[model samples]
Target: MGTNTILDMRGYRRPEPGTQPAYLFPPYKSTLRRAPTKPLVLLPHTLSEVTGPVFGHDAISPGDDDLTHANGGEAIGPRIIVSGRVLEEDGRPVPNALVEVWQANAGGRYRHRNCQPHSPLDPNFNGYGRVMTNSEGRYRFQSIKPGPYPWGNHSNAWRPSHIHFSLFGPAFVSRLVTQMYFEGDPLLPFDPIYNSIPDENARKLLISSFDWETTVPDHANGYHFDIVLRGRNETPMENKR
Candidate 1:
């Protein structure tokens, strides 16, 4: 890795709102009542909330970044390299961030009990992985491409192939959990979870592009994905007269 790349800070991704249709958004026949519509009331920050629950990752497993071999043998799928950097809204690197990732197997099957009967679980792949940012605020993972799976959100709702990423940055407020999708995934247009994002550009931010230069011969295909924790500024919303 060379000197950390200073990514362009223009048009950063928009944060996820609580009203996304697949998970948070409430519908008419939604058994759970929706939260009362109200403007967000920003409160003063507290010392306790600011600094608490520090994690010690000294004993992190060495195999954490290699999901395919973490269990024992190689997982059956197309091998690929997932590389990215964690940066702040101001284009500063956020070194030492803990990134936890989980995904379905190459067959689009999770190891969870709920999915046991439907999709065969790969004994060679448990589908969980993690990595910490290096001095340059960069991290990499060696894993197989996850497959798409169907969710009965609608008549035939199939989620696109994606990897779930949980980022724990310096501050408690910097903790963010988001899903990263691959570029040109045909299922993106039909998936409710992917389409929940209202902004097209914001949705594009969640997708990763393949990097031919990063591709290693006879090793794994490389995909580049950079995460910007938050935006530097927020456009205020005011009621129209």
Candidate 2:
């Protein structure tokens, strides 16, 4: 790792406890039976554990960040551009951090087989993108607005259109990921995953804003999102509601 990467990792501060509520979190399943108990074994943080996978120049293809035209075809949906910056809690830029994203297509369906049976998969849309932050901690990509899909969590749970993001910072501990949402989506009021977060403002940060300046005429609209990995004001995941 380079000097900047080391600094960013060293600055890592785990999120505060008791902030993430249990009921709001969607993926954790509810069961009536008692859960099994397990022991906590401390693991050593060796070089392998500290550093994630490495990549080279050849690993990235041109237009890799543009999901609208993947596999030499245009996806059927309203094209949009997502732009953002990755920063440390102290307001420093995290340069060259690898950012990976995945989401459903305009049809609220994923290309994967396990997706719900009702939504049809789009042959033209792959719904994934990967890009590295620039020297100033900035990154941008183009994709379609994913639609809401039904779920079994509640009587009629449907996940809001969202993009899942992953970031690899300098160290293993510094690695973090989050989901980004579009602003003003009516579904925001009812989405449990979005509501899982205890802080209202923190949840608002996940929503992106429309940017006319970044929008291309007769082509795609523009959206801007800024990501602050961990800041002095923000802590990592918490157990408290």
Candidate 3:
């Protein structure tokens, strides 16, 4: 049986009529109505431009520092550096793109509903952060290595280590909602979210490579994950459909 069918049979709530499936619809709609036909412009390669700083400021970079949110309590874990480029399908840089990342804290926990009850919540680990691509379409953040947590799937099942990524292209039509996975994560093969991508090439695109250079002192490890936003395609009059 299909995964959804099994879940539904197990009493998982189904959407009401006229409502979209929770996992099927995007959170927001694009305002753009027309697709551009010109050749896609790739973003620049050199990092430049000072977009505003991101959240988790105190926790950024590797360190033994504590993560205390506005609420209270300390977040524990190893520091990690997450960096990547925003590019177009043609491998061109896409500057000014907005990249947002949200993830669980070190103890394999999150501030969300499914998190463990005993895990001390870190007020600082709000799990939400945003950054803009520089002139070279680059972005970076320092965070703790998120631990895999269990769900209802099996006796010992666990979600993979992942970071949620939201990207807004220069044009409204270029928006994308995706997640980045760490290389060699054991849960990748079993995670329902990761298996949702039908295409292997597309699936691999979400897994980031480890980059030692980006690992700043106090950071646990470094990851460089790039994303390519689809851009307008150029076509001659005769080639227009």
Candidate 4:
């Protein structure tokens, strides 16, 4: 096995209470149907779950990490840079972690056909990107800021501007999913998904902060969002049932 093998079996810390969303958060209407009706059967992580399936740089094509330019023309909207580190519970770097993101365009519509047709689509933005974290555990991408979109979760329920993130650990089974919200979106307070996490501080971890250092002059603004795989301060992950 190579040095990048993530086989340390020290075991991950259980997320502190309220740091993660409940499987049955009623306000997030989708969970009402999908949440398990019975107690979950815990599965132990074996060798297959903890190691192998490495992601190398060869999988990344030019501009794969830059959503704004990946589809040829620049994506429409206010360009922004999102950068962060993928850290372990103890703050160790997770090198070569595959971080993927997808989101709606500035018009509050996703590129998928299932998305509502109420908003105009930007021909330039497919709104998907992936990058491998560096040896220092840092990853970055450039994209237009996503816009809020109304959903059927509640009456007049418009989702906050956000980006969806998926991180793959050593194995495919270790993949974790979460969302990143902008620092000051007013819609956040009303978003059921955002409020699903019971702890105020834990919910705050999902919001990215503006970063002057990463902001490019006359180009994209910057936001920094560090993701902790697990710990007392872990980012709220989507409930997996």
RMSD of each: 7.8, 5.7, 15.1, 5.3
Task: Write down the TM-score of every candidate.
Answer: 0.80, 0.79, 0.66, 0.88
Question: Cα miss at 120, model 2 (Å)?
Answer: 1.8
Off by over 4 Å in 3: 1-74, 113-118, 153-155, 236-241
Model 1, span 1-241: residue lDDT tens: 3332212212223445632334344322232355445665653223332343455667357888998774567789988899989998778897888899999999899888787455677889988888889888899998899998876566766779999999887666567888989999999887766676677777788999998967889988999999987543332221010
The model with the greatest TM-score is 4
lDDT (C-alpha) at residue 213 in model 1: 67
- Model 3 vs. true fold: TM: 0.66
Candidate 2, residues 1-241: lDDT per residue as tens digits?
6875533332235455543444324343442233334653544344454465655545556777989876667899999999978988778997888888999999889888888767787878998889988889999999999998887778888888899998887666567777888888888888877777778777788899999988999988898998876543232222111
- lDDT, each prediction: 0.74, 0.76, 0.64, 0.83
Worst 10 residues of 1 by lDDT: 232-241
The better-scoring model by lDDT among 1 and 4 is 4
Best by lDDT: 4
